[model samples]
Target: MASRGLKFVNIQEHSDARGNMRIVEVDGGLPFVPVRSFIISDVPTGKTRAGHAVSCDELLIVAQGSCLITARTAAGLEEHRLTPATGAVHLGPGTWLMLSEFEPGTILVTYASERYAETRFFEDYVEMDR
Candidate 1:
């Protein structure tokens, strides 16, 4: 189920020529808000995470390493192949995201507008749409 077709997810990039280091930040001030900030890592190769979406909006970045993030919406599913030193990926409500194709040591940093609530739709994509 690819939903219908995702609108399109952005994969930001940050670079530093000094030591050849790039930093990605999801700073405040956007159409959405941020209530919590966290990172997800230690995922096995080819394993997928991101079983849920935010009721408001979400900002994500690849803190370290790299992986693939797919945004699934009622419109369709859009794939964003992320890399280290990139900017944040913004996701909105009623969106199902799957983080897969990890390159080992892949880390995902996320910013949300809500607290960590298990009651939120982590899976079961049906209700997420409704």
Candidate 2:
């Protein structure tokens, strides 16, 4: 399944008569302070995004709808179905991640420990596995 470097974190949710909210913080919820963040949405059906690995850590949240995430690990390939109810997944270095099967209007929110740097990214899964 998933590499030990990848972990799932259930973000704390606060709900009320108004709505629901989740809290993400350094040393409290998130293990590290995110210097960069991004959102993935509007992914077309049958399209898949793969071959991305970074040197730092990553935290992914299913903000809306659902999607499937697959990561390569030493043990084998591990797959996870992510929905707003499942919370987030924290992936450390050396893990290859692929995202697909996104429902319409699905939103994926990502937080990274470091800012963007071409040198910090490895497009090859083999390079990341090392």
Candidate 2 residue lDDT tens string, 1-130: 2244778897989999999998888878787889999998999998987567646788999989999998876556778999999989998876778898999999999998877773265675563332
Report lDDT per candidate: 0.64, 0.81
Steric clash pairs (candidate 2): none
How displaced is residue 85 in candidate 2, in Å? 0.9
Query: Which numbered prediction scores highest in TM-score against the true structure?
Result: 2
> 10-70, model 1: which lDDT tens digit per residue?
5534456654443333452343556787888899876778666545567777877888877
TM-score of 2: 0.87
lDDT, model 1, position 111: 69
* Prediction RMSDs, each to the true structure: 5.0, 3.7
lDDT score, candidate 2: 0.81
The CA-based lDDT of model 1 is what?
Answer: 0.64
